[model samples]
Target: MQPTESKGLSSSIFISRCRAVWIHIGEMSCSSYKVKRISGFDPPPARVFAWRVLELKEQGVREDDAMAVADMEYRTQKKAKKKAYKELKEIARSEGKKPPPNPYPSAIKEIQAEEKKYVMDRLFNPKVIEIANKMKEERDKLRQDRAADGL
Candidate 1:
């Protein structure tokens, strides 16, 4: 573009106009380009399902109701259902006078054991350590090769 001396519009005004025109043309061109649709299909039905969480909020439903709805719709396993139910019941109990049901002993024990295993694996994972060592060795070899090449 040619540099303007004293033109019809000031330099900054001219630049802004150019930017606006460019953006308008770009947007028009992009709008003309066809975007692919994901699929001509509907979503699968879940046994339990909640409406979109945002829609619930917009409709001014209580937080507990929204979460419960979401969990019921989305959670597939019995364990997940139990967890969601327990949480909802607990919240309700806290708000009211009734005490929440005691969780089943077997389920509680299973949950505890699973949790313990998760913690142990996170803290001391032999496979992870082996992988880390191998990665460090590979990186060191690459560094050595680079140094030899004066890179």
Candidate 2:
């Protein structure tokens, strides 16, 4: 049977095979197979956490203390959301209809899973901290260069 006609062949496996065939025929560049990096945009929860930590740091809080406060604030916000959803669920049940699905827990789990993939929790990952510092330095250097050029 032809590879493309094979039953239950996963898309990724099929694509890889096609790519290999194309490369052998000199029809595709190896450069096209390079993985693209994720963009610099932060997710909402991450942005909020970073802002809170930065605000605390600007107010003279130590790095560890700032991160702790930010972490607590994030947890508190999540807890409040879960509590609100529970209240809504109870109200729906009282009116004799099936309670609506509670989305907060699932959404939080998804966000946490995504964060885990990126090692985004700086408090737990020293590598993230180093990357953040390097990014900050690059930003600051760019600003200085722009100022010197009268831009």
Candidate 3:
């Protein structure tokens, strides 16, 4: 394991050449290294899901389709349960059993709903109405101030 002397080439060039290739006397260089293949691989669930969504998009699927696919099973189960409940209600009615009261909102909620609608109308209607109301209030205040000053 003696350091080789640089006879002709520059020191940097000799080192670079040695680093790039091994000089062997009628034998293969670096024979002690062996290559092996890896196996037994599995990806995480979130990565798999992201790849699946991207695949769907690449195949020209709508994003909504991919977004809704995750919740489709739950939605189908909910719909099936509602249908079963409706059928049971119909069967009970056929046996002359008194059905439950209508599930509509009560009078109190209806009154509150109307009040909410009025307030929302006043707040979020076209700017014309809001500007008119603001102008009317300012004019009334001005008139009151003038009356107080004159008195």
Candidate 4:
């Protein structure tokens, strides 16, 4: 083996040396690094617990009550949501009934209509029309000036 140098080597040299040692060990190991699958239809243990909490929720258990039983983090509450939604969809499918249309559709339509009305008002109202006409005249003058300047 080479003696350790007193001076530090460049990062690339250090990385290469570490990689060489790692590779040598990896070759002798039974297994190299293997990536485990993290997500699937098969629920993890945490998901199972979260699903139970969701069941309690469906049975009218309050959020505080469910959290007391589940001992999950705030983020893990999302898994309970996923579980609830999945069960809802499944029950709807199994019952041979079309799932109810999203209750917020009219609210969405109202919002879209409001946005369109606002845009139309901005584009065509008296004050807006006057401003738009002024801008058009300014643009025409600029275009004419540019043409005269051969620009």
TM-score of 1: 0.25
User: Considering only N, C-alpha and C atoms within 3 Å, which residue pairs clash in candidate 4?
Assistant: none
Compare the candidates by lDDT and give the number of the best one. Answer: 2
- Candidates ranked, most accurate by lDDT first: 2, 4, 3, 1
Compute the lDDT of residue 81 as modeled in candidate 3: 67
User: Model 4, 2-118: lDDT tens per residue?
Assistant: 222333321111113111111112112212222234665554444444445555555667746774666554347766766676677789989998875443235578789779987
Per-residue lDDT tens digits of candidate 2, residues 66-126?
7788878888988998899889889998999898876655767878878885664766678
Cα misplacement distance, residue 108 of candidate 2 (Å): 8.8
Candidate 3 regions exceeding 4 Å error are: 1-67, 100-151
Which is superior by TM-score, 1 or 4?
A: 4
Single out the weakest 10-residue window by summed lDDT for candidate 1: 18-27
Tell me the lDDT of candidate 4: 0.54
**Who is ahead in TM-score, 3 or 4?**
4
lDDT of 3 at 57: 47
Better of 3 and 4 by lDDT: 4
Segments of candidate 2 deviating more than 4 angstroms: 1-43, 105-151
Summing lDDT over every window of 10 consecutive residues in candidate 2, give the lowest-scoring window: 17-26
**Backbone clash count for every predicted candidate, in the order shown:** 2, 0, 0, 0
Q: Best TM-score goes to which candidate?
A: 2
> Which is superior by TM-score, 1 or 2?
2
lDDT string, candidate 3, 9-83, tens digits: 221111121112122212222222222224665543333343444345445666567535524543575578667
